[model samples]
Target: MNVGFRVHQDVLRPDRALLEGFAGAAVGNLSDAMHGLYTMDSGIRPVVTPAARVTGPAVTVAVSPGDGLMLREAIGLARPGDVLVVNAFGATDRAVLGGTVLLAARDRGVAGLVVDGAVRDLDEIASLSLPVAARAVTPRSGTSTAGWGEVNVPVACGGVVVQPGDVVAADGDGIVVVPADQAAAVLAAHREVEAAKGRPSDLASGGEARRSRADVVFHRTRAAMAERGATVVPAAYHRWPVPPGPTAASRPDRA
Candidate 1:
């Protein structure tokens, strides 16, 4: 019997300038602008203090639900601006990564780590000043079962299928995976969305006004699509309905 272990050494990435464009942009904006084409699920979040954003080409690893072997290998394989994306089946009881691994990744110039499972040593990891996004934290550590996983493979992280070289842009809003081939096109669309709406004065702002605005944007987009015979389903982001009286035609000014 033989185990199938593979690693893709060469993966094409988007231009540096394109990735840099996503530096401070909100992950939600990118997902909304792309019409949720590559949005990751919402459970995963940052554990580090003073949460930082990350944008880089992906170096994907597919491992067992509670294994860290492949992730450790991925750190070595990752490039300076690569985000190590691990598909760990969202297991939370056992931590697949910890402070030591994060420290090594930092030394290797890895941009960030996104784990669908759990991670340990949050305090130490925060001290390293590395951008890390994951589901949970625990004291139980995973076994180093090497030779059982694959690298640079298409892996599902936070419910999104991430392929090697796909651009990953993540922040407190969560992670967004953009196909490597669609990086430029998606970046352009993201720019358009930002330009049309401008950056929110404060992402932390909360009120009925914000909710109403979101609903207005959703309905406006839906109405525009309805005119073209395309029906658009409302996304999860819209927590409220459009206010009375303003239809798509009437809300063209709001976006």
Candidate 2:
């Protein structure tokens, strides 16, 4: 079986602080923070949120269907600020993204997309305002019916593995799969990343280091607990979203 698609290797990655700075930590917290986030799951039904573009906490899709036509139907359902995530159900060599589909995604206000397999329309997908990231490009296209499949269901994709509604972040550095269970923590992590990194940046800007020994202890404790697979440490001290620079992130009050 063939799957996946083509995309720009020069894609851009959003700031990890930007991804983790959201104060809203629930399902509806980043309701409007819809700009980025993508999954590499195959047969995903990516629906674009009709709301304004959000910069953080973008819930991605993972579909494990065998049908390629329904996949296109899912793309039709997307609104705006959405990055369509598709998994070709173990088909990485087939072309799922082509000129026509890329145009449709763009016309529907979709912002971007990611696939773990291959794509056919290279020049056109690149030209659209919608950003696409994938593994390879091919001269092939998806079969109207590759047999059977489902939409909106959880499916494993890419190297990290993913499920529907899991938050995804993609950029030039590649894509990060944020589990739905970890969304709040991941979203919360960005703040610390920004703050931790910001401490250095502030000093670089001739500002003082506001962090204290207590803060160091806090991170150390969290890191220790996390290393043991405990929930005591948040993503801030664990991994990703790393520590931010002194500048930190610019976020509006979510409350």
Candidate 3:
């Protein structure tokens, strides 16, 4: 079996409706629904416009630091509305993606691109208007040699394990991974969160109901923290007195 150089053709994607539910969802709220986990590190941020919000199944790619052969193959294998998630071992010295290949991916109907490595051609990429999140950017391009890498396999990107076909919801906040099998449950939980924050319609209508709900939640949380042994000081930490120390006048002068 070609371990590192193989591609798994079959991937289990979640239902289209389930994925669609996350289209305009905030990554932060989704992360909270998952117990504040499954979020990519802050370093992996939107290199493109922050207004871009995308949700789709992930096509996982594991590429060597300075090579992008497997990534190119993954793009061809990706279906429309699939996010190409590339793991390049967080290498920043060389870029594994650039404008030229990004154009091809865009034309192929790829939803977005998230890389745990560098990428170049920001101007062209912005012009394309495809959502792109990466760890860094560099002008040095990767080699196209058929090297060791894997596609549609579990990979670590930005300190989170991403599985093939997992729902990837990315926005200005960051990227959040929802396991394919648990997508339904996560969506339900996310809806509950939104409800607790007050319906979007209420907030949009400039009603006080949303603010009231927020206040309730904030006070409840504060009380819970106190009950759990969180001490509340009457004054700020900076206003507290410092330990006694010898004053400059009390110290002996040096010759």
Between candidates 1 and 2, the one scoring higher on lDDT is 1
The TM-score that candidate 2 achieves is: 0.54
lDDT of 2 by residue, 136-224 (tens): 66777666554444444454456555555455554433455666566556555554554544433454553134445457767988899
The segments of candidate 3 whose C-alpha lies over 4 angstroms from its true place after superposition are 199-205, 225-255
Model 3 per-residue lDDT at 199: 59
Q: Give the Cα RMSD of candidate 2.
A: 19.1
Taking all chains together, each candidate's TM-score versus the true structure is 0.76, 0.54, 0.85
**Tens-digit per-residue lDDT, 30-70, candidate 3:** 99899989999999999876559899999999999878788
Ranking by TM-score: 3, 1, 2
Q: Highest lDDT, which number?
A: 3
- Candidate 2 — worst ten consecutive residues by lDDT sum? 45-54
Clashes of each: 0, 37, 0
Clashing pairs in 3: none
Task: Enumerate residue pairs that collide in model 1.
Answer: none
Better of 2 and 3 by TM-score: 3
Model 1 misplacement above 4 A: 1-4, 200-255
Cα TM-score of candidate 1? 0.76
Rank order (by lDDT, best first): 3, 1, 2
